[model samples]
Structures are given as C-alpha cells and as structure tokens.
Target: MTTCATELLDKLASRRAIVAVIGLGYVGLPLIRAVAESGLTAIGIDTDPTKIEMLKAGRNYLKHTGGEWIAPLVEAGRLRPTGDFATLAEADVIVICVPTPLTRHMQPDLSYVEATARSIAPHLAPGRLVVLESTTWPGTTTEVLKPILETSGLSCGRDFFVAFSPERADPGNAEYDATGRIPKVIGGDGAEAREAACAFYGLFVERIVPVENAATAEAVKLFENIFRSVNIALVNELKVVYRAMGIDIWQVIEAAKTKPFGFMPFYPGPGLGGHCIPIDPYYLSWKAKEFDVRSQFVELAGEINSAMPRWVVDRLAEALDRSAGTGLSRAHVLVVGIAYKKNVDDTRESPALRLIELLESRGARTSFHDPWAPVIPPTREHAALGGRRSVPLDPATIADYDAVLIVTDHDNVDWSALAEARLVVDTRNRAEREGLAGPRLVKL
Candidate 1:
C-alpha cells in the first residue's frame, strides 16, 4: 500500500479522521448524521447559508430526516455545518455529495461536481481521501475529477486517495437509512485507492462492495436505475395495451406477482419520476454514443416513459367526455398527491408536473393536493408550476371536480373520500384496491 493509503486506513481505524461532507442536502445530511452517530467527527460544508444555519441550529429541513436525530449529534459537537470552503483543509476525508442534473438538451451537466472539485483541489493534502458520491456517467472520476484534483500538484493514489462511491439514497423509505441499511459500492483507479476507499467507508457503512474500478462503480448506479426505468416502461406500455383490450393491468400485475420465481413486480404510473429513474438512463445512453453504440432499450424506454403524461391526459379527457359529457376544455380536474412518490416531498422529475401542464394546455383547470408537499416548489425543468399550493381534500372538494386524477399513491389520502368524486381516473390503481367499483371509477 502507498503511504497515503496506509495513513488514511490507520486514521479511519483509529477514528481520528475528520470526515467533511459537502452539500448538506438530501444525501449529505443523512451521511453526516451517520458519521456522527458512529462516534466520528463530521463537518458538513454547503454553499447554502440557510441549510448551514438550519444544521447549526440542530434542525432538519427534510421531513424524512428527523431533527431529534440531528440535535444530539450537534449538541455533542460531533457534527458541524458550515458554508466556508476554507474548512476543507481541516478534513482528513472529503466526500462530495452535490447534485448532477441534466442540461436543457438532456445531456449530462457536471457543473456542481466540477465546481466542488475545483474549490477543494487547493486544500487537498497528502494522506487525505476524496470520495465522490454524486451520480454521473462512467469515466467521470478519472476523466473529469482526477485532472481537477491533480491541479494541487499532487499524485492521486500516491499523495492522496480518491474513489467513486455512488450515493444510494431513497428518501422517505422507512426500511432503509443512509448509515448502513444500504450496501455502499466503492471503486478506485488502483488497489491502494480501492482498499483505502473501502476501509474508510467500512467505519460507518455496514456493507462495502468493492468493484473492479471507478468506472464500474459509476455504471452500477446507472444500471440499477435503468433496470427500473425499462421495467416500468414495459408495464406502462402494457397498461395502454391492456386498457384498449378492456383488461385491468393492475389485476394482471397482482396475478403475475403471485409466481414465486421469474417475476418481480413493477407497477405502471402516470410517468417516470424521482432523481434517478427519469434521469440516470440518459447518462448511460449518452456515454454509450462515444463508443459508437446505440442504447436502443434505454432510448425506447425513455420514449415510452416520456409519452405517459400525454397518454394519461388523453385518457382523462376521454373519461370526462364519456362520463360527464364534458370535454377537457374548462374541465375542473383535481390532481391527488403531486410528489414523485409516496410520503416524500421531493418533486424532482415528477410526472405530476407534466400532467398538470398537459391538462392546462388542453384547457383543463388543474389543482393538486399533496400532504407532504403543501406547495409546488421551483424545479429546474418546471419553473412555471411553482407558487401553486395544494388544495384541501374533502367530500365536497372531490364532488366539485369533473375528474380526480390519482398520480401518486400517498398512504395518508382518504381513499373513501376520493371515491365520492364525479369521475376518478386512477393511474396508481389506488381506487380499485380500495374496493371502489363503478362506472365513475377509471383505471390506467
């Protein structure tokens, strides 16, 4: 092992290493909490002053991450939040958890990651470990980050250790926590870097999966999300085909899931959503083009998934016309649960935004109700949908709408109350499962 790798491993083993986690958003906050909870000193660095203030005050901004967990850690002096980049020099281990969003043309935009890399490169010293937890295309660690870090005039695996470890954060998941519930996948350029990366994460993470190289580790994250995207696209395509044949896709899925083997259930939705599913596959597809290979599955899945909002709007308009003799124009439609998934406030790439826009363009007046997200926040893609607040749900409110569209199946919604709608278009199969059967109810 190299001198830097050996020193990092020794510091990690003795719990003497100070872990600096950049970006105090969804991914970084939980990781900082985990490191602190593991009895290790963690300093959270972010450019957002509001987030830094919230963390310093021992409060939590994310609904899934409780303030009770953070208060004790802050009080014990194990966790510190700051907006200064100068503190980067004090950390023995630096973890980048910034966002990697796609550009307007649906290309990989690594501005946040690149900016963070440039900022910290000046502070990187010998024996320090830098691990990137941001999701990106393969070769990002070597091609993009390594060169930026080498600006410090130090050799990477020799002067300092570097690795790629994708963050597997599923917000609002009750069964999984960032600390140890999810196995961490780590990789680096050489054996010393890989071993040092694994050993560092082994301190707080319960399971460490060391892959062949950094590129493989990056590909693993994209592959996992692409698998979901493709499978969901398959079910979504089937939902349309089954609907035209006067068959219920939800019942078919329920039956197919009964098979003990060879079948894993993936349900259809209004469209693909969340930070990963709707976005990550494009990164892989974009990367594949460099090798002169076309990723047909990814392209087809994206096409199918992207068309779902229009399909759902078309179905809703037809349902309205059939049930109430009203076209989409001037129709009062209420959207239930605007969040990407159940019980989470995160709305990145949420299908509900597209559904609302499509409905509005068709002259349908749309309103939404999400218990978690009281108001639609500004998004990188759907800035026009911002400032809209969630409408209250009740029997009277349900009866007023021409149709109630169930986009996200949040558990707290009163299904019984929703059953009273004039016409209900259930995209998530929420009504049928609740035993609400009638011509007034429609499923996609």
Candidate 2:
C-alpha cells in the first residue's frame, strides 16, 4: 500500500512533475498565479478561448486579479493558460478548481467537475496526484469524481492518487492570498492518499489538516460556507422582527458580539450573495435528500436569503409611499453599490441585482452607482436600459433622485454626497462614513 507521507514527499522532491490547474475562473486564476509565483511553471487550462487569450495578453478577468500584478506575472513565461487537455498527461500534480454552482432549483450542478474529470481521465497516469478544490457535496471526490477518473481502467490510490481539498479562498480579501491565509483541509481514499494530498497543499498553504477520506474534506468546505449562510439568514430574519420592535438589529448584533464564547457575527444583507454562501449550502441540501435526510437549516437559510429581494422591494415601496412629495410610481431610486459585497467587483448572484428588479417593477425608476460595476444588466423586472452606468458621487445628482438605496457598501462610495437626499434606504448598514451622515438616513 502507498503511504500518504511517503507519496507526498516524493512528489515534491521530484519537482519535475508539471503542475496542471483546470478551470481558470475566480478560483483557478488566482491559484495559477500562486503556482507560478511559487517558482514552478504551471499549465492553466480553460475551455473559454477568450479567457485563454486574455491570459496570453496578460489581462485577468476577475476583479480581484489586480491587473497590476497579474499583468507583469503573465509577461514572464511562468504560466500559460491554454485550452488543451493533452497537458493533463504531462502533469504531476493536478488541481481541479471548476465551478460547482447550483442549478435553477439550487441543486448541486456537478456537470463541470465530473465532465472535467472524465476528460482528464483518459490521460491520467500512475503517480499523478489529483485534488479537487471546487465546493461540492461530501462524497463528490470519492464517489462522483473517482468513478469518472477510474473509468479509463485505472484504479484510485492504487494505479493513481485522488483526494479532496476544499478551496477556502475569499475572492476579495486582499489579506488572504492563495498560499497562506487559511490552513488547507485534505482527505483522500486512505492514509496514502491523505498524505499525498496534504503534501501537495503543504507546498502552498500555511498548514494542512488530514482526514480519513475525501468525503470529510468535501464536507469541511460545505459546513464552513453553510455556517455563514445560516448566520446571515438569522440576522436577516432578526432585522425584520427587530425593525417592528423599533430596535436596530445592527445595534443588537454589535452588542452581542461582545460575548467572548460561542458567538461570531455575520451581518445581515439584502441576500446571500457570491459563489460560495448561496451555492455551497444547496450542494449539501441536494445530497442530503438523496440519503433521506433533510438539511433544515440549509433549506431555511436558502429560502430566507432568496426571499430578501421581495422584502427589499416591499421596503423600497414603503419608503416611496412614505416620502413627502412623491409617489412610488414617480420616485427615482438610486441604489448605491451593486456588487455582491463591499470592495469586490464580482457580482455573480448579487442580491442588489434582484433588488433593482423589484424596485423597477413597482414603477420606481432605478439607477445604480457602483464604483466597481459601471453597468447594471437587466434582470427579472428591469429592462436593458442602455448607458445605466454607475453615476459619480455628486451630491447634486443625489439630490436629483427622490431616494437613494444603499444595497452594497463598497469602500469608495461617498455617503456624505447622498446625505441630503429626500430618502435613503440603508440595507448594508454602510451609510456611515467619516464625513458622511445626516438626518436623511433611513436604516432598513
């Protein structure tokens, strides 16, 4: 039997193994940069030819990729983002960072991960280490992914190696680099696979926690994101109830965070946004149903977070109804911040998108002002309004709009500019700025 510790040490010392990273998106792109920066040349594989061209031209599509750094790095020959799969046969260490986004029903969509594995399987060889970093259900690595890899008459842990190492990268956090911000959790088929997986991540991560099998590693990522989804939902629920009681949920949370033990705070938002929190929980919920278990917290959190758009719309309607000289039908609402969260440009599954739609449906004319996202695309209720780019932080324009809604609290927004507005709906609790705050603020 292959020993985990021995296998890992051998792979690293051999540095002759070509590093291959599949799926060059938010996660894969950063990882490719890290692998290249680590003094080893890695092959970045992506199906999107445009993305490949962007990489070749030294332009990264992700908002977090910071064109300043990636541009110079790609100028060198350390990384090559290619559309070829034949590179898989040349890899010693292969990390799969494909998307595990939810389907229309919020079910685990493994088509990319599974299909990628099948495609790479034909070229998979002995002594190659395979690690999956995509957020997924618990048994995906050992069950769904392994079957596909073994389809080429190759056995896992025997003929080759397989493991799961859940990626915990916070896309927008400048402090959390791919190499060291968080410790990596690794699990595999057995002791050997576990060690090999640990050794591989040990090269970049601060530390590694090895478990008995790949399922455990997969579960770790799901549980971490699910915790955030539930806590945020809890606050979202509390925000509504507390508003009725005339107590600010944000105030209560800030006070409750003082308890040293058993308490960590997750702020309330318009909805759970981004690729992880909104999608990872559903992976568990979908898998739970297969085993006759109902993940109630996950389901409830999902339902509550998803419904926040409607609630925000209702609140915007109420804001307009209560306004002094205008009706909801004629009110011009300016939503500040459209990205999923503050300081990040990524808007995948952003709650602000839904909120914008809800506002427009009620006859409230809406324009967004996001420093990151210049243009707002149409969703369920909004038409494709051309040139609806983010407006500059001008108090005159703020005064022109009847109401200014704070959907996302990105860093650069000048809250003071909107202080003189006739109405303001503060959803992300971001109206407070160093020189900003006035009587016009309405906490939602």
Candidate 3:
C-alpha cells in the first residue's frame, strides 16, 4: 500500500488533485489549511452556517486557528468554503474529519460521521479517494462508513477509493505544524485505494505509512489515546490515595521523573476531558464486550475518572469549610478556568462542566471566568440550566467570590492575582506554581 503522502506528492505537483474536506472542526480546519498551503485546490464543507460563514468571510473560528494562514489561501482562490455536497463530485480527494463524540450514556455516537458520509454519497464519482480522518472504532470504516459511501451505486476500490487515516491532530500545540507532523497512517479497502489515498496525503504531510488495513490504523489511534486514558487514571487513582496521606501527587510524579530511565510522567486533575483520552478507550471497551473480553483496566479508569468531579466537589466543600467555617452551600463559588484542558479553548468532554453542575445542585451559586471563552454555549446536559454565561476576571472581582476553584491553567490568566485570592482550590497546581506563601490554599 502506498502512503497518502506519496500519492499526493505524485499528483499535487501537477495541480491535478481537487481536495474536499468535510467538517470544519479542530481537526478539519487545520487539515484544509495544510491542503491549501500544499498548493492543492481545497474545498471546505460544513453544515454549521456559523463556521462556514466564518471561513468564507476569512475569519477563523478557533482561537489557535489564525486567519493569517487561511486568509491567503482564500484570497488566492485555491481554497473555498461551501455547504453544498454537489461540489464533492468534482473532488479527486475527500477527507472526512467529522467528530465521533460519545453519547450521554458514554456510548460511541457515529451520527455526525454517518450523516456526513451520506451527504457525500450521492455525489460519489469514479477515480475519487475518500479518507476518514475521524478517530473511531476499528470496524467503522469497513462496516459503518463503507456501506454508507457505496450507497450511490459506486463500488469502492473499483469506482472510487476509500481509506481510513486516523487524525493525529493535537489542537493548540505549536510544536507540531499541520504539515510538519511525522508519519500519518493510511489503510484502504484495497491496494489501488490505498495507493491513491497515500499519494493524496503525501502532498501535504511530511510522512505517511500505509498500514495493512483500515482496522490496523483504527486500532493504532485507539491504543495511542487509551494509553493516556489508563496512565492518567493511574495518576488520578494515586492522587486520591496520596491525598489521604497528605502527599502531593504532582510532586511524587515529578520526583519519579528524576530517574531518567523507565518513566514518562502523567498528571492528575479534576477529571478527563476533550475528545481523546476521556472517550477513545471506551470505543475499544465497547468492542471488547462484543468479543466477550472484559477490559477491566479501561473500565476501572473510566469509573475512577468519572468519579473525579464529585471528588473535586468534596475537596471544594472541605476548602470552603476550612476557609469560611461554613458549608459549600450559599457560598459564592467561582470557577477560575472552565476549558476541558489547559491552554486550549476546547471544552468537549470537560469535567469542569460537571463540577459546576454539582456545585449549583448543592445550593451554591456558581460562576466562571475564562478569558479565552467570553461566552459559553448551551450543552445537551446543561441547556435548561441557562447554558453558559460570562463573568468578570478582574482583581477586585477575584475577592468577591468566596472560593476560587482552578480547573484549567491558561498561560494568559493572571497567576499572581489568583495566588493572592482569599481562598483557592487548585486542581491543576496553577496556584502552587505561583509560590504563594500566605493563606496556603488546598490542592486536588
């Protein structure tokens, strides 16, 4: 099987490949940026009017997605943003980066991917290559997406090429560029499809490795994320155990890393978040049940990780009582950070949302301040709870809250002022790193 990079490099120089991208998410947008910068004729498709409009107007939706990179491509007419699936018929290559988010029940939700495939199926054509970049279960490309894509009477591998290349995009990391990331995996339903897909990706990516099959590529992505899920769970479990012994888990891990051999450090926090570590392992767990294999480590980690929000609430309750001699109820609890992870604005599966809900349920008035996120959107779980609103992040306002719970650690947020806060519950060690001496605060 030829790698996507080789196939792309072979054709992209001739300006022959017409690229179409589905879903303008954190994964899709950067990919389109790469495809455009590679000199490919790129078309970006999205159902979201807001995102589509933003791209068309040369505005970047994501904070890390700068307009400087996309504006030039759009101006040159090499890149386009469209809502029409009819344009897919004109594509030589199509990349699907739609989200495969989890259901509220923690089940694999393939609605977005399936819906996007169906939208493109009607326009399926010969000599076209379709690549699935959405991280999903192993059988999804073969069993789920294949059937949907072939519905247009297009026989895959014969009339069109189909492949699965799990996206390795790490949002908000400056170290890895869209095209500079090394070694993307590609697997196809057949050799021709595999070669074509690889050649297509080779145009943009620096390295591409063609795997044996789609299942291999899918499993590779699963293992990559599941490793983090399990390790973070280990640290989370250790954090809980060490908390009882009054030892900081972060310090313990940092000290362990002092031994240069046999240890890569992972941290503990309120809970898991975003699209990968928190959810990817569960897809394997679900698949394991079908094979009658119990994934105990994965399940146990999910359980412990899930319980972290409540544990955080307990810590916050204790902090409030210790600081004010009263319960958490009726306390003006302010969340210092709300994003799913530090330094990024993504809140996909953030446990901070759950902490806010738990706090409010206990009769405590809750508010949040995230400079990156001036406004919050309504979530499926918190829609009736007034969705999300903004709060003041000023110094005077910092003293107004009874206790400040730091869920995320953005670099821009004033750490000095936060350390001086009257009462603080540091989940991410943001306050501790500030070296605040007086009014020592609690840490999770």
Best by lDDT: 1
Identify the runs in model 1 with alpha carbons over 4 angstroms from their true place: none
CA lDDT for candidate 3: 0.83
Clashing pairs in 1: none
Question: What order do candidates take by TM-score, descending?
Answer: 1, 3, 2
Cα-based lDDT for every prediction: 0.90, 0.80, 0.83
Tens digits of lDDT, candidate 2, 277-334: 9888888888898999999999899899999889887877776777675777788888
Error of 2 at 176 (Å): 1.9
TM accuracy, model 1: 0.98
Weakest lDDT window of 10 consecutive positions for candidate 1: 172-181
Name the 10 consecutive residues with the lowest summed lDDT in model 3.
1-10
Return the top candidate by TM-score. 1
Q: What local lDDT does model 1 show for residue 259?
A: 100
TM-score on alpha carbons, each prediction: 0.98, 0.94, 0.95
Tens digits of per-residue lDDT, candidate 1, 123-159, equal 9999888889889999999999999999999998789
- Per candidate, the number of residue pairs that clash is 0, 1, 11
